[model samples]
Target: MLESLLDGIFNGISIGSVLLLAALGLAIVFGLMGVINMAHGELMMLGAYTTFVVQNGFKALGAPWSDFYIFFALIAAFIVTALVGLLLERGVVRYLYGRPLETLLATWGVSLILQQFIRSVSWQFAAGVGVFCLLFFGALWLISRRPDFEQIRGKAIAIMLPLSGAISLVVSNLLGQTYKFAVTLPWFGTQGVDVTAPKWLRGGLPLGGYQLPYTRVFIIALTILCLFAVFWFLNRTVWGLRIRAVTQNRSMSACLGIPTQKVDALTFAIGSGLAGVAGCAVSLLGSVSSNTGQSYIVDTFMVVVIGGVGKLVGSIVAAATIGIISYVVGSNALAPLVEFSPFLQGLLEFFATASMAKVFVFALIVIFLQFRPAGLFPQKGRTVDA
Candidate 1:
C-alpha cells in the first residue's frame, strides 16, 4: 500500500511537470504581453514535429548516436518554434495589440491555420483564403463603386494587399489541412511518429523496497532546470530588466527609449520557445503528433488561470496541487472507499473513470474560483487594471 501511494505521487509529479511547463509559457505571454495567444499550442506542435524530425535524422544516420538525439532535438525544437513565433508576432499579433477580443479571434484563426497546415487542405484553409480574397477584392469593389483611382482610398488597397497575404497564408494553411500537407522535407515525415524515451530513462530505481521510474525522475529534474533557468534569465539579465520594464508599463518604457515593440516580439518568441521545450519533454513520454499540443493546451490554460496569471511560483504550486489531487482522485487507490457506504461507492465509482475525473476537477476549480476570484496569486498594479 505504501509503495502504491509513493508511485501515485511520483506519477502526479510527472504530470505536474508537464503542466508547469505549459503554464509557464502561457503565464509569460499572457502576463507580460497581455496577449492570450490561442496559437501557443500550435507552437508546441511545431516543437514536437522538430523532435520527430531530429529523431528520424539520427535514425537515418544509423547506430549509437541515435540514442543521444534527444538533446539536439530539444534545441532544434526551441529554435524552430521561437523563429515561427517571431514571424507570428511581426505579421499578425503586433497589429492586434490592445484589442484583446480581436487578438483572441485572430490568434484562434492562426491556430486553425497551423492545424490545417499540418493535417492538409481543410475548410479552415478555404475560410482563411476566402476571408483574405474578400478583404482584398472588397476594397477594389468599393473603389470601383466610387470610381476614383487617385483618391486616398484607391491606394489603400495596395497597403491592404500586403496584410491580405498574411490572412491568405493563414487561411490557405487551414484549407490545406483537409488534404494533409505533403510537403515533407528532410527529417520530418508527413505524419505522426512514435517516440520512446532513451534507455537511460526507461527503467526504474529501487528505493527502500519500492521503485520509482527513471522517466519520472528525469521529468522532475528537467522541470527544476527549466525553473532555474527562467528565474535566472528574468532576474539576472539586462534583457530581462527591459522585459520587466515593458511588462510593468509599455508606454513608460517606450518613453524611456526602450524598444517596446522589439521587447514584445522577443517576449512572445521566448514564451513560444518555452512551450516548444515543453513539447520536446512531452515527446519523451508519449507519441509525437500534430495534435499532441492540443491535448494539454486547455489544461495549461486552467493552470495559469488557477495559479494566478504571471506568477511563476503560483503556477508551480497550482500545477503540483492540481496534478496530485486529480491523479489521486482518479486512481484506484480510493477503491477501499467502496466498502464504506453505497453512496460513497457510487460517487467514487463515477469519478474513477478518466472523463469524470476531469469534469470533477474543473467543477472544483469553478467552485474554488467563486471564493477567490483573483486566483492563487494576483498580479499588482497595471496587470490588475488590465
Candidate 2:
C-alpha cells in the first residue's frame, strides 16, 4: 500500500544520492579531459581504505575522541587521493593525452596495480609516502604561484612525468606488508569497524505511512551539498573560469595564456578528490574492501555517458533517472500493482530479479544512446579536437 510506495520512492532517492557522488567525478574527468580514467574506481578504493586507516587510528585513543573520527576520515580521504591524482596527471596521464585508447589501457593497468597493492601492502607505509607526495606537490604548487615559473609551468608536468611514475611505484611498495581490509569499532559494531551514523541519524522518521531511514536523508543532503559546492567552485572561482575556458576550447585558451596544462592537472585532481569523498560516504553503508570501488565503475560511467559528458545538469538528471528506475524495478515494488494480469505478472516477475533489472536498465541506456548519441545536454558551439 502506501507504505510500500513510499519506501520504494525513498529507496530510489537514497540510491540516487550514491549515484550522484560516484558519477560526479566521472562526468567532470570524462567531460573536460576527454580521458576515461578506468582507474577512477581505484582512487575511490584508496579513499575508502584511507578512511579505514583513520578509523583504526582513532580507535586506539579510547572513548570520546574516537567518536568523531568519521569527520576527519572524509577530509583525509579527499586530500590523500587528490595528491595521488595530481601525480597520476603529471606522470602517466599527461603523456597519453589525446590518445583515448592508450589512456584507457594504461589507467586500467594502474587500477590493477592499486588493487593488488591494497590487498597485499601495508596501508600505513603507503599512506606515509602519500603524505610525502602531498608535501612535495604542495611545494610545486607554491612554485606555480611565482611569476618566474609561469613560462616553465607547462613544462613542469613534462619534466615530472617520469618521476611521478617512479613515485607511484615507490608508494605502492612502501605500503605495509600486511593488509587489513576492515576495522573494528565499539560504537559502530562489535565485530567490525562500521561507519555508524550519528545518534540523530540512527533512527527512522515516519512519513506518508512509511518510515524513512535517517541515513538515507543524510546521504541525500551530502550529495546536494557536494553538488552545490562543485557548482559554486566552477562558476565563481578563477580556477573554475580557467577550467570552463579550457573546456570550451583548449587551443584557444592556451593561446590566451590560460595555462591549459595546469588546468588539466588541477581539474583532474578535483574530480579524483570528489571520487574519494564518494568512497568515504559509501563506506558508511557497506563493507570497505579492495574490490568495493570496482562495483560502482560501470554505473558511474553510464551516468556520465547518458547525461551529456560535459554537462553538470545532464549528469544530475541522468543519475536521478537511472537511480530511481533501477531501484524501483529491482526492488519489485511494482509487482503488486500488476498482480491482476497473469501475463504482466510473469513479465514483472522476470524483471523483478536484480540481474534482470540491470539488463533491462542497460538495454534502455543503449536505446537512449542510439537516439541521442550526444546525450541529454550536449555542449554547443565550437568543438575541440578529441
Candidate 3:
C-alpha cells in the first residue's frame, strides 16, 4: 500500500515536470503575444530533430564523444528552435499581432508545413536547416543588439540569409559524405528513434524502498532549474523587466522607449527555445518523431489556461495538480478502499486505466474552469484588466 502511494507520487511529479517543462514556453508566448502559436509544437519537433542531428554528429566522431552527446544536443536544440522562432515571429506572427484568429490559422498552417517538411526531407537536409537557423539567428541577434545598425538591418539580413543557407548546405553535404542516418518505413513507418542516456544517468535510485528511475529524477531536476531560471530572468534581469513591461502594455512600453517588437521577438524565441529543451529531456525517456509534440500540445495548452495565461506560479500549481490527479486516477489508488466491496471495486476497475484517467482529468479541468474562467491567476495589468 505504501509502495503504491510512493510510486504514484513519484510518477506524478515526474509526469508533471514533463508537462510543466513543455508548457513553460507556450505559457510565455501565449501570454505575451496573445498569439496561439500552433507551430509551437512543431518548434519542439525541430528541437528533437536537432538533438537527433547532434547525436548523429557525435556518433560520427566516435567513442568518448558519442557517449556525451546529450550535452551538445540540448544546446543545439535550444539554438535551432530559438532561431526558427525568431524567423517565424519576424515573418508571420508580428504582422498578425492583436489578431488572434489569423495568428492561429497561420501558425497552424506553419505547423502542418513544418511536420510535412520534415517528413519529406532527409536527415542531412534537416541538419543543414538546423545549422542555417542557428547561424542566421545569431547574426540577427547581433544586428538587433546594435541600435545604430538598425537602418542596415534589412540589407544585412537579406545578405546573411542566403550566405548562411549556402554555408549550411555545404557543411551538411560535406558531413553527410562521411556518415549517414537512414530510415525505412513502407506505409506509415515504424516507431520513432530513441536517445541513449550517458553512463552516470542510467539505472535507478532507491528511495523509500522503491526504485526511482534516474531519467525521471533528472527530468524533475531539469524542470525545477528551468522554472527557477525563468522566474529569475523575469524578476532579476533588465531584458526580463522589458519583457514583463511589454507583455503588460505594449503601447505603453513602446511609448516609454522600449523596443516592443524586439522584445516580442526575443520573448517568443525564449519560449520556443524552452520547448526545444523540453524535447531534449523527452527524447531521453522514449522515442521521438514528428508527431511527438502533438501529443503534449493540447495538455500543455490546458496547463497554461488553467494556471492563467502568463502566470508562472499558476502553471506550476496547475501542472502539479493535473499530473497528480492523472496518475492517481489511472493507478489503483482507490482500490485499497474499495477492495472489500466487489461492486465498488468493479466500478473503480472501469475508470482506473490510462485512457479513462485522461477523460476524468479533462472533465475535472472543464468543471474547474467553469467556476474560474480567468484561471487560478488572472492577469492584473491595467490593459488586461480594462
Candidate 4:
C-alpha cells in the first residue's frame, strides 16, 4: 500500500512538472496584461507542430540525432511561438483591451482557426503537394490580417486568463478516463499501451524492488531548472527588474524611460518561449497533438490563481500541492473510498472518468475563488499595484 502511494507521488510530480511549465506563461501573461488568452494552447500546439516539422526535416536530411533533436525542437518551437505571440499582440489582442469577454471570444475564434488550419494542412498534405501549397498560401493570407503592436501588448495579458481557463476545462473533459500510448522503437516495432514512449526512455530506475522511469526524472529536473531560471530572471537581472516594474506600474515604468512598449513585447516573448519549452517537455511524455496543451492548462491556471497571480512562489507551491493531491486521489488506495463518498460518487457518476478529474479539480478551484478572491499568496506592497 505504502509502495503504491510512493509511486503515485512520483507520477504526480512528473505530471505536475508539465503543468507548471504550461501554466508559467499563462500566469505571467495574466498577471501582467490581464488578458485571458484563449489561443495560448494553440500556440503550444504550434510549438508541437514545429517540433514535428523539425523532426521530419532532420529525417529528410538523414540525420539521426533523435536525442539532440529535442533541444533543437525546443529552440525552434520557442522562436516560432514567440513570433506568433508578438504577432497576436500586435494584430488582434490590441483592439480588445479592457473588453475581456470580447477578447475571449475573439481568441477562441483564433484558436479554432488555428486548429482547423492544422487539420486542413494535415489532410491536404496527405492528399498531395499541390493541395498543401494552396493551404499554405491561404494560411499566410489569413495571418496577414493581424493588428498593431500597441494594441496587442496593451490587451494581451488581460485577454489570456479566462480564455486559458475555459479551454483547459474543455480539454480535460475530452481526454477523460483513458490513457493512450503509441510506442515506437528502432529495434522493436510499434506497440500500444496505456501510455507510450521510446524504448530507451521507458522502464524504471531500480529502488529496492521498485523502479522509476528515467523520463520522470528528466521531467522533474527540467521543471526544476525552468523554475530556477524563472526565479533567477525575476530576481537577478536588469530585464527582470524592468519586467517587474512594468508589471507593478506600467505608467511609472514608462515615466522612468523603461521603454515600456519594448518591455511588454519582450515579456510576452519570454512567457511564450517558456510555453514553447513546456510544449517540448509535454511531447516527451505523451503523443503530441493539438489537444495536448489542454491537459495541463487547468492545473497551470490553478497554480497561478492559487499561488497569487504573477507570483512565482505561489505557482511552485500550488503546482506541487495540486500534483500531490491529484496523485493521491488517483491512486488505488484512495480511489475506492473517493468513489464511494456520496458527494464524490455523484461527481464520479457525473464525470465518470479519469480524464474529467482535471475538470473536477478546476471546478473546485472556481469554488475556491468565490471564498478567497485574492488567492493563496496575493502579491504584496507596491508589487501588485499595476
> TM-scores of all models?
0.81, 0.81, 0.82, 0.73
Q: Please list the residue runs of candidate 4 whose C-alpha ends up more than 4 Å from where it truly belongs after superposition.
A: 60-64, 122-200, 335-353, 381-386
> 212, model 1: CA deviation in Å?
3.2
lDDT of 4 by residue, 242-354 (tens): 98888888888889999977777777777777777777667666666656556556556678888787677778777877776666554433555575587866655555445
**Residue by residue across 1-386, what tens digits does model 2's lDDT show?**
88786677678878878988988887788877788999999898888778887888888976886777778888998899899889888989989988999999999999998877776554454565576577557657977898888787767766565566567655554443334343111122212345555455667888876677776787788889889999998999999999988887788898999999899999999999988988888877877777877888998998888888788899899888888888889888888898889998888778887788888899999999999998999878754445
lDDT of each: 0.80, 0.80, 0.85, 0.68
- Model 2, global lDDT: 0.80
Question: Who wins the TM-score comparison?
Answer: 3
Q: Is candidate 1 or candidate 2 better by lDDT?
A: 2
Provide the global lDDT of candidate 3 against the true structure: 0.85
Tens digit of lDDT per residue, candidate 1, span 293-369? 67888888888888887788888988998887788778856767468688887788789766788888899999989
Q: List the residue pairs that clash in candidate 2.
A: 121-176, 122-175, 122-176, 183-193, 184-193
Poorly placed runs, candidate 3 (over 4 Å)? 123-191, 381-386
Task: Give the alpha carbon lDDT tens digit for every residue of 1-386 in model 3.
Answer: 78787788788888899999999999889865577999888888888878887888899998889888988898899999999999999999999988888999999999988887767666666678789989999899988888868798889889999999999989887767766544221111234766777777798999877778898999899899999999999899999999988888788888999998889899999999999998888888888887988888898899999999878899999998889889988886878877789998887788798889899899998999999998999877553311
